[model samples]
Target: MGSGRRNLKNAAVALLSPIPSIIFYLSLLNHCQRISSTASDGDHSLSLSPLWAWCYYHPLLLANVLFFVNVNVLFWVISHIQSSHWMIDLYWTVIPVMLVHYYATHPLAQYNWWRSKIAISLTWVWGVRLSHNYFRREKWQWGAREDWRFTDMRLQYGKHWWWVSFFAVYVSQQVFLIGVCLPLYVIHSVDEPLNIWDFVAIIACLCGIVVAFSADTQLHDFVSRNQKLKELGKPFVANLDEGLWRYSRHPNYFGEQLWWWGLVIFAWNLGQGWTFIGSFINTMCLAYVTKLVEEWMLKQDYRAEAYRLYQKTTSVWIPWFKSSIGGKDKKA
Candidate 1:
């Protein structure tokens, strides 16, 4: 989950506000130029919904706009029902499935079908793992818990949070998604056959997923063990600078950035090198987003000195840097 920061939310909105329109505009322009309302005979055999009849002229743009709209509306409704900020968190992982389905059923599906499937497959694997992690953290329950930052913002904004959240939290996040996933919107529809870039992209994407899965699993187990230890009236673990944590303070964040870069790679060779802005936007988000999360976390631990020492030794984002702050004796 993003763990919204009160100060950052407004800034994030300012920084990311332009992307959604750009994506929608580009999507509309791209599809309007090439796509048509009528598909060839074979596409008619697919058991697509009647909605496709309306989307005939601009299937990708239609899917793109519909998805972006549906998600924010759904999140708004869920937030009212549960008053939880993370109501939209799981959507981050799961929405790609629907995206893949939409593109796969498109007339362009007949173009680079297999390569697109590979991209979708990698997305599915990462999505499933990430969704499971969120659920395992018990975030799926409506009203069970609300992220602290949302609570803070609610107090800070008073009644304004009702409207502000609709834009800053929900809409802004969708803009980020639409921008970063633009390649997915662009790639499958093209009729190019598989190329070397596709293979390289698949491997890099899988590797990123593996890194993320491994890092998140490690953190989950560490937290779980510490919870049990606390329940048993024992001391909690001092530092988490173990495993991938040894290399990067936030390995999962790094891995996700890598994963999106891999997706960018998929479209890079198809005259889509310019698509990296999406990945760049996400990387910029991670740069301070993790710091916001850590601020909240540090409050929970109340171990400023230990965490500071840990921070000094460990690289903040990248891994395998030339520093060993690892004494293991000092508590983080």
Candidate 2:
């Protein structure tokens, strides 16, 4: 009887491994957003109910339910999970980051820069569309089941031990999101701009947003077409080899990395000095998160011999480059 049940520890490890940091960070942001709403209620006094109750009740129960439900809803409408791309989350975080970064660089509180307006505008446009698209893709309902990872966790944690698992998932993610958002506070407080670097930063931020949008749209088209091909038994092919995929194995990822760093660059250019360092940290975190995702997915395809060949011939994290042996790179 015991042998028939999967180990809770093993399930937790599997559920929590690979991209825990990323999900935690996302949940953290969601929690912070909730906290911010509370602050807007004009209650300066600290509240213990939700924070205390929910903080310890994360990751295991709350986080998975929220995240999994979110994903399923997105996939249901968009035909794919929209925000499943970790890049989308990373890039979305930039909206707050830009506000914080801009405010930090400009402390005089008089400069009215149009770039901030544009950045913030594009940020929301991209974010809302992406979020809505994701919501449409997933199939979510009351009493709905969970993804395999969470199911695995339930087996190991024991049927009676669900609350603990829920706490782990929820609380951990809440903390992670809040930490990453610290940069927003710094960026939002600024009100001055100096040096030519500020303009350059603005250009970079705008360009990054545009590139990211293009990359995501292109990928969406590619994936949709590929699915049709699969239905027709046309053999799995890297359709990305035609458009933006020709230049980079992950153009969307590249654009997303740029989107975050672009905001960071803008903040530094505004003369916040050390605050600009957050860009590097943010970039590293995103890279690590995406790397984990790649590893997880790559290992799942047991019959992916052709996919393996593509991975070998193409760049994994970076843009593919033309080797002396001849293959497409970012410049293709």
- Let me know the TM-score candidate 2 reaches against the reference structure: 0.54
Q: Where does candidate 1 clash, by residue pair?
A: none
The list of candidate 2 runs beyond 4 A from truth reads 1-119, 132-184, 276-278, 300-303, 318-320, 324-332
What's model 2's lDDT at 153? 51
lDDT of 2 by residue, 244-266 (tens): 55556676677666665565665
Clashes of each: 0, 50
Q: How would you encode candidate 1's per-residue C-alpha lDDT over 71-91 as one tens digit per residue?
A: 676557656765666656656
lDDT of candidates 1 onward, in order: 0.71, 0.47
